[model samples]
Target: SIRLPTPISKPDRSYRVDVYDRPQLAAFMDAVKDKYDNVDQYHKLAYLRLLAFTGIRNGEARALTWSDMHLDRDEPFIDVNKTMSDNTGHGVVINPPKTKAGSRKVMIDAETANILKRWRAIQGQALMRRGLPSNVVWTNQRLSGRISSNQPREWLLAAIRGTDVPQINVHGLRHTY
Candidate 1:
């Protein structure tokens, strides 16, 4: 019988927690909002705001549809019951939550809800112009499909290019929240 060698354990294993402090978060949010003021940039603002405020996974946010949002309710909330998995051998696919807790409804603040409302209106107009139905909350500008998973990261990098705030990935925004 052959004996396998024991796995080696490192004594010093420290994980870096990348998150923005309160003031830094405020600065980042302000920078994101101010960096893009054009009519076409509304979706980006809405996406960033949702990530910063909701603490939901980036994939979950990408999976959000107009049907999952309840902005008109007395208590506005988002149903984070699904996620988009791009790792499938075939391509991007939508799937239900792996855990029961993952399918929870996250209540959002009025400000965030209002931002979404404005985005919906802008998106509705854009869809109407193209004779498309109002479905996804965020979609590719050039393409009619949903925005790619890398879009939020690209947007974050662009927004924080010259800012003093430490650079973090899109998931870090959720950690910040």
Candidate 2:
């Protein structure tokens, strides 16, 4: 093989983080609440609000079970000790946090705690209607299964479709928090 010179290193380019501001976030929340009032819609709204108010990663949030959340405690918090990882051919699996520090408890404000409470009540009723057990915090409204990982992002996209708010990925909401 012919000798080749070393490749030149590219300069680092900093990109701005895209996130919803106060007014935009308020508008987005209002839009979601006003447009979707059903139990299933409430679940989706709660999920979005949680991500917006907490900086936890998407996988961390997805991996959360009802056991991982302590909403009734004086200081409500969700333990972020694991993440939902795609195991390729084996399908999705729950795994420990990537780092020791990744496994932490994220506390929520009273408002958020109330939102979660409402969501749980609504979810419980829906599950009872379908004769399904309430195990996961985020479950498919029409079926007996966890909500798909892409569902939250899809909901966010649809909520901001015609609004003046800038479009952003679900992760951006974490940054906004």
* Top TM-score prediction, candidate number: 1
Clashing pairs in 2: none
Please list the C-alpha lDDT of all candidates, in the order they appear: 0.86, 0.82
- Candidate 2 segments exceeding 4 Å error: 1-17
TM-score of each: 0.88, 0.85
lDDT tens per residue, model 2, 68-169 = 889999999998988986677987798999889999999998888889899888888877887887677877756576677788889987877776667778
Against the correct fold, how does model 2 do in TM-score? 0.85
Error (Å) of candidate 2 at residue 20 is 1.8
**Worst 10-residue lDDT window, candidate 1:** 9-18
Error of 2 at 80 (Å): 1.0
